[model samples]
Target: MAGRLVLDGGTVVTMDGVRTEYASGHVVVENGRIAAVGPGPAPAVDGAQVVDVRGCVVTPGLVNTHHHLYQWVTRGLAVDATLFEWLTTLYPVWGCIDEETVGAAATAGLGWLARTGCTTTMDHHYVFPADGGDVLGAEVEAARVVGLRFMLTRGSMDLGRSAGGLPPDHVVEGIDQILGATSEAVDRFHDPSADSMLRVGVAPCSPFSVTTQLLTEAASLARDKGVRLHTHLAETLDEDTFCRERFGCGPVDYMASLGWLGDDVWFGHGVHLDDSAIALMAATGTGVAHCPSSNARLGAGIARLRDLKDAGVPVGLGVDGAASNEASSLLEEARHALLFARARGGPQALTVRDALEVATIGGARVLGWDEQIGSLEVGKQGDVAVWRVDTLAHVDIVDRVAALVLGDRPPLELLLVAGEPVVERDRLVRVDEQQVTDASREAGRRLLVKAGVAG
Candidate 1:
């Protein structure tokens, strides 16, 4: 059985239908579901674990649609290179990953995300040393231990440099082995219910790392199991050239050939999608995870986010791989979405509302969980994050919604996942922060040594 709680009297910003925002509002939680939310109190708060967030901005816990949390140990090594070069610079180090390194980095990353007011995150773990033990299970346990909603993508790479792919051969797997392990993990871990805290996605890394047969088979297997599909698509001009030259089609058409366009499908980066790709995604109700910070870091062009959103494609936010983005705060990453889109398309291209929306509900939609965890409403999961208005935009308090967009961040105050507070006063409660930090630092050192990048 779950516990009950009540968050009383805060500025509730429900990015539900119509992008509603209310000042001095009350939200109640019972058994991990938001029992009631409105301007005033209900009968539910009588004996609940009452938390008064008087000066806080209570909003739906932000969602992160894509990340490589273990890549935290690979940061600062892949700089000043395009996507292919960057992958070359880092894959060897990643090929050395073990359960301990993956678990520590993932746990630390999730802890940081929770303290940054993100309660849910989707990790796109594409590294498979084949020798690395239970990479998926390691990350799942890390997320659970860190107390965040976990969508672990059972990702694979079946083609390598020897076979004209990006990753080295040591990191790629046999197609049969990949599919078997993926199917087994889905059966063993994926929960289909609306109330399930954990779900699994089937991802085949990217076009440059896997064969077409593997992509098609992965998509077919994903459809057979009724799970979501994810992959990296069109993040760089080099990738665009690769698609046009190799496949005689763009990324979207190639995906369509694999039966990979639907509401259950989400492609990361999506920086190089053309008008046709945008139309196909919108028509098929496909989702995209926009990696704004990673695009900026890798010198990949900014994604046409406003165009995609305006075209009716479901858009969400992603931190991408830490090796590329190097930063993990999605709320802070939301600011990058605003800045980058504006840098390319001018200020009106993507509004702050749209940026924040992509981080929360839009991300939920991409992950196929909008109905359960995206908004603050009755019968939805009570995953809430309280962002203090006093951070740097005190004057913008007149406009709370604008403050989230334009104001500087106050420290994250309380982060609740299913009505359980995992971060309070910006401190993690699930694991000793010091222990995780020390473990991660050691792992980072080891990752560099494994690559011979450092002694």
Candidate 2:
């Protein structure tokens, strides 16, 4: 458990600056760090666990910057509504959530992520029903069963409809309770080391769902604990209007006044940000989690990703929440990002390599984990995934990256985290697949019944 392993005879595609690909390459993993990466005739094959991946495409495991893993239970319930309508349609069902339901749903969602080649993911969970018993701990336990690198955000929504916010009163918490729970989560669950697997972030839900004071204090607490902060901002025109009316300032200016414009923060669904906001983000080294599929699903506008990247902003790809996107597949999200970007700003706005980089290195960088686990390079973590390129989904493709992004779903062979296999041949290894599916379906049934919509 504490030695090196050599994955030789594979097509290692490192999403480095050049998107380098090495045929018949060997990746040496020692003490969890990639010792070297090159062709065969590598050092130390004497006692290492040699995985001969001759025909597999070995690359860094996909990184997901945003998710609401508990939304797995509400996937089909809010199918064709906009952001506001969708939230209103699903809030009643979500109000019935308990810790047990969230645990089961999150486990299934994270397992799906692993099956699609994701090793690291950040969950943005904000719903806190009045009756839910310690939902945060339940999601955390689910991550352990799912067996992936996790960024668990202690997400809070303090402003309810009584205060002119979107969420119902029963789903929101007190400001003191929110901040107190966040600090407790940081002290208990947050890992601040270089080799940590479970890192915690302070997230104040969104501008509409939380007060300005909550954002300021959340940022302060995150900085004091040296953890990352995340939330939603400027997702749609309605959100922009809410910010202007409620805060008496635009989203960017409000965040700036709260000292939230910094490198350790990343906002989700940044589709409605203006040029000046982009400039401020670039100057402050702040990051954005671009959710292309969720935007299209909810009819939200396209994010100016190429513009953001051009302005030197850190842009990462996310699937958002499964309730909006229908599923949490990193490869599917990458494909959507490429096609969606081309649809907005012409064909060259985003390339296959750029899309791939967003799912891998860019996401890691956004979560501030690039140094430990992003690309298959020397001194990086051994988080590798093997997707089968021999199938019809990848047939007759000259460009390997195109074979992945442009075609149908490629058959996955294996996915690893820290050199340990979590997915093998397109199946999850850490969970009982059928059990999780049954649990999620049952939870959905209960929710539907509680909402008086079940047949």
Candidate 3:
């Protein structure tokens, strides 16, 4: 059911185990898997589509490990607020989202990520309005229409303002309702095949927004169904204080006591984790999705990424909520990771290659997809991103690999997922880009009016 194609003559950055770089290379794709990769034209095949990428830089397609796809509609609204203030201000507004709003936001967000060279994205959608019917389904359909691999987290929040959580009551659901709906959605959507285009995970939004009972039950359910677990942890001192005050232990200890430290679990924006917490993560093989932009934007402190990596913790990059980062560009997110790491730990903190690794292989590992989509290996999925730097910004750059992270990134020249071209020449081919833009704007306007944030 898959086609044959060849991307010939480019600077291939194969993020394999050895981190191979090919100055002038060709990658052959057959039946949705990488057939061969070497430093020349591929062997001739019958009816194969050959694409010339002579002056381009071809790398494994970028992976985004964590995001709140529905927050695109609320960008620029809570710019100056800290994490708590921002969530408090936006919770009431998010309470107004319906299926259409969620769908439009997911479509726009996925399109933006694709435009920036992402082939796989994991969305954490937790804000379920009381009457928001099938919000998870809406996002799944949007991902289908956008033509990228989708990993949707059936995120839930059970603690509300009345119960001392930040989100408004209307946006949070009862424990029974959340669990039932989450299991139902997982049964209806999760695909466990190696080449599955869709996969579903269970995520209880965060420690502050959920109850201990809910967390335990969600973890139990995820283990029962053989799915993954995700949540936000240790993003701020306030969260640490909340954990100490509420649970009489640190966030890591709280999670460990609940049996949440393992390879099948990952936490987002792990900014405030201490040395002990980092050690725990490394010991249990738990992963971290480092959202530098969102953390900096919300005044959350820098994550100890260098320390975590040195301790053998799986660290990945995330764009987080568009409302926090304001851009869903995985390349730019990589750049930010580099910049923030240097700002925090000095010039030797993170290199361009390190940042790029977090965006590619690191992300794949975080999402438990390392074997299939992270590298351009002979038997891996045919997901590649091509960027041309022949323009003025890259004219005199001797090290093109550094240019991808240090300089202005050129728009993606081409993107392929499983031998299927979804973006070519910086345009999304599966759907009208302008139409998705317009629909998202309309949805934002309607949400603004409903939340009474409109001018």
* Candidate-wise lDDT, in order: 0.86, 0.86, 0.91
What lDDT tens digits, residue by residue, belong to model 3 across residues 212-310?
Answer: 999999999999999999999999999999999999999999999998989999999999888899999999999999998888889899999999999
Candidate 2 lDDT by residue in tens digits, 181-222 = 889998999887777889999999998889878888889899
> Which residue pairs overlap in candidate 3's backbone?
none
Which pairs of residues collide in model 1? 391-410
Q: Give the distance in Å from residue 237's predicted Cα in candidate 2 to where it truly belongs.
A: 1.0
Worst 10 residues of 3 by lDDT: 394-403
Q: Of 1 and 3, which scores higher on lDDT?
A: 3
Q: How displaced is residue 15 in candidate 1, in Å? A: 1.2
State the displacement of the C-alpha of residue 138, model 2, in Å, after optimal TM-score superposition.
Answer: 1.5
Give the lDDT of residue 306 in candidate 2.
Answer: 90
Q: Distance (Å) between predicted and true CA of 239, model 1? A: 0.7
Write down the RMSD of candidate 1 (Cα, Å): 1.6
Candidate 1: tens digits of C-alpha lDDT, residues 105-137: 898888888877788899888787756787778
What is candidate 3's local distance difference test score? Answer: 0.91
TM-score of 3: 0.98
Error in Å for residue 409 of model 1: 2.2
Which runs in model 2 stand beyond 4 Å of their true positions?
1-3, 40-44
Model 3 alpha-carbon drift over 4 Å, by segment: none
